[model samples]
Target: MDTLLSIFDVKLAIENLPFVLSGLPMTIAVAFLSMGVGALLGLFLALGRGSSYRLLRWPTRIYISFMRGTPILVFLYVLYLGLPEVGIELTAFQAAVIGFGLNSAAYIAEINRASLNSIDTGQWEAATTLGIPYWRTLGGIILPQAARIAIPPLTNVFLDLTKATSLAAVITVPEMFQKAQIVSGRSFDSLTMYITVALIYWPLCIVISAFQERLEKRFSRYVNE
Candidate 1:
């Protein structure tokens, strides 16, 4: 216990807590911003994947395949480092957000596609028989039902995105992990800083998971009725 305490440097961790926490806002910003982008892009990708036109379907399929196959770290490097070679310089934050957003969209697209597909064909038929336009049927009837099925998976994606924001440190985005890295370097105690950051992430994820449970229950109630 004494040896562990000596290595961990609890006093240093306490002292640097504020500095480490200072980056929390940026971490949250990157996560939400990336999620927003991913949600929008993923929705369109899902729709495209389901479209009747081969042109739309094939391209979306290729995009999803490529994005899913590639490592997100490489994508981030391409955006932040490789793009500069083509005179397309972006700030670290911009690169992080765009990279994470694009990568996450592939996963979200699959979730959206699966959710949208899960709605019964009878619902579509009934809407069509009622003289509802395709868009109206999709928006007014199918999507709401599909949303209930989607909430859980989408929340999982959001949770993953939130934690994955730590990868932004590679490009020098001043997020929580980056701050923790700074603290670790300054204090010469990598284990404690990394553990502290992990502990911080644990509570944040727990809160998000609790919120997911409430959201699932709320949506499930609507479905039950």
Candidate 2:
């Protein structure tokens, strides 16, 4: 109790707060940026993953397999460090964002594919009866439903990305973990510094989880009622 309370001292940590908060914008920016990129790429990946034709599916499968199979650390290292050796230099932040975004795309693709599949087959048939084009029917009828199913897992991915941002520390992105390291170095209080960072992480995730629940309830209304 004492240790926890000690770490939560707003007054003592007040000066430290701005430094921590400074990194937050970047953290959140990278998170949202990555999610946006991941979602766009993932949409295609999901489509390809569920594609009926082998020609279309194989390439997508290979990309997903390669990304999902590799460690994120290894991916980052290759992009940020190794690529420079091959004369393809990238900024650490850019490399980290791309690496993590690409990885998240693989997982998001599977989530989207699963969610797309979860929609009732009759929903598609109903759209067919309306003489809607396939793409139009998907946009107008199917996607909204799939989005609801996907939201919970997508939020789960958000939480994961939030935590994974810590990996940016390894590459000196000046994010929360990096700030913690700097403060810990100065205060020689690594324990307190990290505990505070952990506290911030926990609450953000809890909020995401709460919002996910609310969204699910709202979307389920057409059926539950």
lDDT against the true structure, each candidate: 0.92, 0.85
Measured by TM-score, the strongest candidate is: 1
Model 1: lDDT equals 0.92
Clashes of 2: 0
> Can you write out model 2's per-residue Cα lDDT over 1-225, one digit (the tens) per residue?
987676565554666867877788778777878888888899899999999999889999999999999999888889989998989999878987898899999999999999999989898898889888999988877887888889988988888997898898888787888898898899877777787788778887898789889988888864564
Global fold similarity of model 2 (TM-score): 0.88
Error of 1 at 87 (Å): 1.8
Q: TM-score for all predictions?
A: 0.96, 0.88
Candidate 1 global TM-score: 0.96
Q: Give the lDDT of residue 78 in candidate 1.
A: 97
Q: How far is candidate 2 from the true structure (C-alpha RMSD, Å)?
A: 2.4
